[model samples]
Target: MSSSFRAPPIPSSDEIDLVALFQVIWKQKKLVLAATASAGLIAAIYAFLTPPQYEVSSVLRPAAINELDALNRSEIYTLPPGDALVRVGASLESYDTRLGFFRSNQKLFKAFEQPGRTLEQSFEEFNRNSIELILPDPKKANSLSAYIKLEMSYPKGVDGVAILNGFVDYAIATEREQIAADLDVIVKNRLNELKGKIDAARSNYEVDKEARIASLRETDSLRRAQLQDELKALRAQLKTGRIDRVAQLNEAIGIAKSLGIRKPSTPSALGESERNGSSSVMRTEINNQQIPLYFMGVEALEAERTVLMQRKSDDFTEGRIAQIAKELQLLQSNREIEVLNRRENEDLFLAGVQPVRAEEARLRNLSIDMSRLKLVTIDKQALEPLRPVKPQKALIILLGLILGGFVGAFIAVIRHLVKTRQSQPQSAALSMLSNSPTMVGSDTGLNKP
Candidate 1:
């Protein structure tokens, strides 16, 4: 019992007077209810007057594997299903493409056209606010192959479903046409490149042929010159030999005439003459180089000299000359050059010509029917929406009621404070009169010491 409990401390003045505030609000309950009702009525009227908005959406997915197989063939243009779907999505997302579609199909959006706004301006507004391109989240896997979503909003009367469907089809067609054009341009460029290579190869072949022909001509000319020179030398040697023979015969004929010889005599007759008139000498010398030219009679020597001098051509006697004449005749025309000149198709001879031509043919024949190619598969088609997306009357009314309750409570607090402030002066005067030391001419003369 000696342990004493500490007294509770006084509450701070900063604490809120929640009970007093609640009592004030209860006292002004009629005002609060009236404000809430008025706000709800105004909200209902505004909700009824606001225009309704309907939304139609369509989903685009990846094309089939077989549909993109042709485009991916040979790797000339690789377009996977995902890639094709992405391309179509990008085309759908293009503002210019949407505007172009709008311009082409203006009849579809006739309801959007009203007074005070041009058709183009209405279409611009529609393009900005109505059409929306929604892409899929990259973080999640889409089992349905949902590549993109196209959303369009319209008024109560406009047909947003039809507009969305038409635009989607138009975008796919435009993408396909672009693909075809790109393929065509690439094919043509490849063909031209192949053609240029072929032409360059042909030019190289011509240059090589000309070079070979020149080389052959040079070789043939050198050979002909050598043959001509050899032929000339042989003819000169033959002529000189004939002249030497004639000189030798003339000298022998003079020796025979001095020795009183007329007919051809053998060495034995000369030997006999030497044995009788002079010392005995053998018929044959140790190394008799040849029979002396004088051994033949002067008539024989002279006749031989006349025959050697009267020869017109050495070709008849010299076998080498006839051989040279045959070679010169053979070298008259180069067969190789003739063959090269007679070639009708020079491209055949050029290296790598056949392969180049084959490549060109392949490029030229590279084609596919684009009409059957599918760019995107419409997984979810746009449907006519029965419910309006905008003008949520219930939500608006609920928010209005909440706002009115707060406003009404605030007004009640202000009015209470003003009336309390006005009564403060009268309360002070009454306290002074009642608690004074004495009251003059009052009913009760009560005073405090």
Candidate 2:
């Protein structure tokens, strides 16, 4: 029986009393309409009056196409590799002085200057605020690398696209001009440096040649003086004691005659005693004076002859070597002159520079790339906006209407429930209270009244 009672008849959605709800809405139709219409109108006016925001989108190729060509043809004249040749002029140690000269370009500084800032400060500001560049990932298969994207939002009624385009054009033009001017300055400076090097090399050649010639002259003079001294010594020795070959032969013959020595026409018969006595006397005379005199004469003649011959040979050799050295100096000087002459003679004007020409070709390629740049697939484009994207008027209106209606319905239902409760069986409730013995009278004898 308790189960059959079914938990005091649970309320179902079927018993929601839709007819009653409709009757209440019909009764308050004017209020509901007034509230919904007012809220919707306010939403529409707010959407229309509010300022619109414009989003400006522009794309830049971060990296120019044909990077290899640009690199190859770029007019930048980079400094050479080693410090040995890195110097600008003869006094390579004065690098600061050279750098000071290089930095003295007023025009470049002025061009780089920004309003209300120093030149350096201006340059930093411009560099920092310049168009943001995006580099492509090498791992990707995309042919394009490095692109720049610019985002700008402007107030309503402004020509955002046109303004942004103008700014981009101005930025790119300024960068290009600056690059060209800087490169020109660098090249001219490098040429001047080369000129300085040539001057220094020429000076070195002169100094070296002069020193070598002076050394040769000094050596030759000293050698000649030494040879003269040696000749004077030989002449003195000859005057004091010179050997006579004729006198020697004559003395030998006369001595042989004086000794009664038999001339051996062929073989001769002679006593051993006589031969021995003759040989002994001759040996004794030679030991005493003749032999010493003869040997001295022979040695003096040989020494004088040797000294004269050596001096003659030395003079000849010195003259030849000096001639060769002088010729070498001339050749070296000529070679240095030729190098300078070649550099001077090279007509960098009549014939176009190979590097600049190459760069020209690259420039053409860059131009082609610039021409080809277009949005192949545009995800979005600037539109006239037939209906403004903002405001969402209908949705706003619907939401306000729904909300206001729900609130009104809730108030109406609460009021109805209160009125019905007030009118329900008050007399029956009072009679039940009066019959209960537990109910007490008021302190003023309300029960008798």
List, residue by residue over 1-449, the lDDT tens digit for candidate 1. Answer: 12122333556769968899889988999998888888888888888899998888998888888888888884578998888988998898887788889989988888877789976798788888888888877787864456688888888878788899999999999999999999988887888888889889888998999999999999989999999999999889988988898999999999999976788766777667767975444454455567787989888998999998888976677898888889889889999999999999777788977877877777777768899899778989999887898888899999988988888888888988899779877876776766454434342433424
- Per-model C-alpha RMSD: 6.6, 15.4
User: What is the total number of backbone clashes in candidate 1?
Assistant: 0
Ten-residue region with minimum lDDT total, candidate 1: 1-10
lDDT of 2 at 65: 30
Provide the global lDDT of candidate 2 against the true structure.
0.46
Decoy 1 TM-score against native: 0.81
